[model samples]
Target: MRSPKDFFAPLALGAPEPLREVPFRPSRMIHFFDPSNERMRAKVPDIAPTVDVLLGNLEDAVSADSKDAARAGLIEVGKAWEPGHTQLWTRVNSLDSPWFLDDVWALCHEIGDKLDVIMVPKVEGPEDIHYVDRLLAQLEARVGLERPLLVHAILETARGVANVESICLASPRMQGLSLGPADLAADRRMKTTRVGGGHPGYLVRTDPVPDGDDDARTSFQQDLWHYTLARMVDACGTAGILPYYGPFGDIADPIGCEDQFRNAYLLGCVGAWSLHPSQIAIAKRVFSPEPAEVAWAQRVVTEMGDGTGAVMIDGKMQDDATVKQCRVVLQLARDLSAADPELAAAYGLETA
Candidate 1:
């Protein structure tokens, strides 16, 4: 019954990580595709450029029977992906599963150089991350790879949420964490059927409909994932890693998906997962800072002159705090536009 945090405390104390700092990667839409599916697998090259990150999903989507096939398919597709334009990531089967070790072993040995990040799902605590970190280091050494592979944790289970801070601080290879709302809801046994969205039943009624028919009642729907999302954002921020919002399963309702992504973005998430092709655009749009916001931020930053003393901008206070917010928006805009040509065009960025 050792504490999860103590397991990695020695490394966290003062030791420098063997892994190099990963490149500044923008993952506005971590597009998910099943490598085992021929139709989806074939479209990687063409569709990859359209999204910031292309992920070969070998977890929940791939059945038990197709695990082997999915592993092979993922290697083939991952090795062939264009490195500079899009990040190649994979969601390996959970560590608790039988295939987990094999998936990590083969992926690192076979395609370690090609893969940018390996996402671990249902991460419960720091111990889970420490295990993968050790194994990945060994595999990377075995393959003679120059740069180590990065790890992304999916905070789905309730235990995972509770221990996210330790999980993010577990390793230098830790890239970020994404909210798996579907699994999270199920893990919590929440009374909702929809995936990654607000439930009408989980709402606030207006004084039980005063002076109106009992049946004629209305309530304002509230975001179900707000608390978890905010918590994840803060945890990731403290650890100097990124945070992302996972998919919204209702592919038919793009508006709802956009709203969910926007909520996350406003609350400090850098991006979200795009479950379907259509969601790619929504994620990109919602995650990127709007033109006006970016402009205002730039103005405030320029006026502040080194982000110090207070000033007035359009009758509003502009101080150290306001400058910091402005910098966040501007920095995010720069990152998103760097990888997205369409976004660069919209941002009026000139190319080389």
Candidate 2:
């Protein structure tokens, strides 16, 4: 391991100054809105403060004819970003797309200062990040932009998931990882038709059913993306960045959406994608630990001073491992309290 003093040295010559040692600002929900859509574009000012990150999407949901329009829309929306309450970000088209160059020029050249991070989709490995890193630096230099733009990689392909560690380490501008379950499932040839949720057929069932009584069988469902999310979280945490669970398409089922986001939150993901206005509250609620949970975590920490040895809290065992878990909850709560008054209130924290 490198010494503490050497930890923040620049990762590459032209890469953004290292933000590795800085604490990740809270982004509990990176709300996705198509910049090309008029209704969505209109919602930016209203929703910007409500979300931790406002992503003006320029890929996938955007049609070919709207590519230029999307770029223009992003510029308009980015320039109006609310600094602390919500960050302004834009998802550029894939690297191979014809419009990718134009998208970069519009956002990074025009309103780069207002933009926080640039989300790159279909990231297969570090090489992709390296290309964007170099290009972004060149553009920043060319445009005389003061601050370096950060990068957030979308792990949508199987290859991206496999190479997440390298991608996160590829640049100092790296912000976090977001799991794109739709494309990931397609790439992996998964049998699920729904976007980012458990399939009915994909579950665990009691074996044999008590002497072959098949009619009495009981089944237990599982989150199909658990493995990928876990891998992403471990990699992001290792790199000292953030990890988020991307979109849940079953918007009508708030329960399932909450459950999915909650599971990801418990498993170390810092936030998730909110595709609709309705889903934003769910993501926020699930990502922030409940007041009851915060209380218990605080109790454990108070009992385990110096963060060693063991203690008992409410008849449950609290040891080194448990203390570590409590620390995670408390730290997130404390950091989230800095900007989010609602979240601070939810976690029983005082806010000014």
Candidate 3:
């Protein structure tokens, strides 16, 4: 069995060196909505209060002809948005795209103070982050901004996945990494046509039973994202940056989406993306620890006192290793409480 030190070593590496001295806030769900969409844009103000993070998407879903419109729309939306506990973020066009340069230039110059994070898509390596880092630094300096705007890389390309570590460590402004499944699947030439979930055809079957025995039943529905998500969790965990599961395209199938997000959450992901309004609650529900789990963790900490040595809880063993898990929940509760008092109360936690 591994020691407590070995299990907790990942936390040290996974956490980025504290920069800007900003208070650690719980970004449980980074909600994505198209800024160019009139319906979505109209909903932003109300949406801002409900979600932890609200992102204005200017890429992928936006039309070629509407690139300029999307840019303007994001700026207008950013200018008008009153930053409450909800952080303001924007997903710019990919670095390789023609619109990206203008996207960065416009957002930085127009609403640098308002924006919290600039989500850079298809980040293949550290070089992509370096370029943006330098440009953002220059922009921040020009705007006379106090704190530098953070960057969140989208792990979508095959090259990006291959170079995730370098990208995560490329800049102090690198806040987190988000797994972009659809683009990654396309980039990797994956067989599955569906976005971000298990595929029934992509699985292994049991071998035929030996002589005279009945045919054995087999497993069904393989997790197509297992390899990628595991690698992503390892990469982010090792780097001290946050790991998030990307969007579930089938908004109608909340069950499958919840399953995917829950898998990521259990694998140590901090959060997941919610593309539609319906997905917001699912992501929030899955990402946070259960009440029973939280209460149990609290009991362990309360009983352990100094947090050293073995103890029995409900006839199960818990030691220093369990304290770390308890701390994880307590820390999340503390962070969430700091971010939103109402949510803290909803979870029955006292606001700090």
Query: Mind giving the per-residue lDDT tens digits that candidate 3 earns over 91-206?
Result: 99998789998998899889888999899999999999878876776666666666678888999999998998888877667788888989999999987778788888887766
Q: Please give the CA lDDT of all the candidate structures.
A: 0.85, 0.85, 0.81
Better of 2 and 3 by lDDT: 2
Which window of ten consecutive residues has the lowest lDDT sum in model 2? 7-16
lDDT (Cα, tens digit) per residue for candidate 1, span 241-262: 8899998999999999999899
Cα lDDT of model 2 overall? 0.85
Cα lDDT of model 2 by residue, 1-352, tens digit: 3355754554445444556553577788999888878888897778888888888899999889998888888888777665776788888999989988988987877898898899999999999987897788788777767667888999999899889998988777788889999999999998877888788888898888456878788989877988999999999989878899998999899999999999999898999999999999998888887889899999989889988887777789889999988898888888788887777877788875
RMSD of 2: 2.7
In candidate 1, which residue pairs clash?
none
lDDT of 3 at 148: 70
Candidate 3 stretches with Cα past 4 Å from truth are: 1-23, 211-216, 340-343
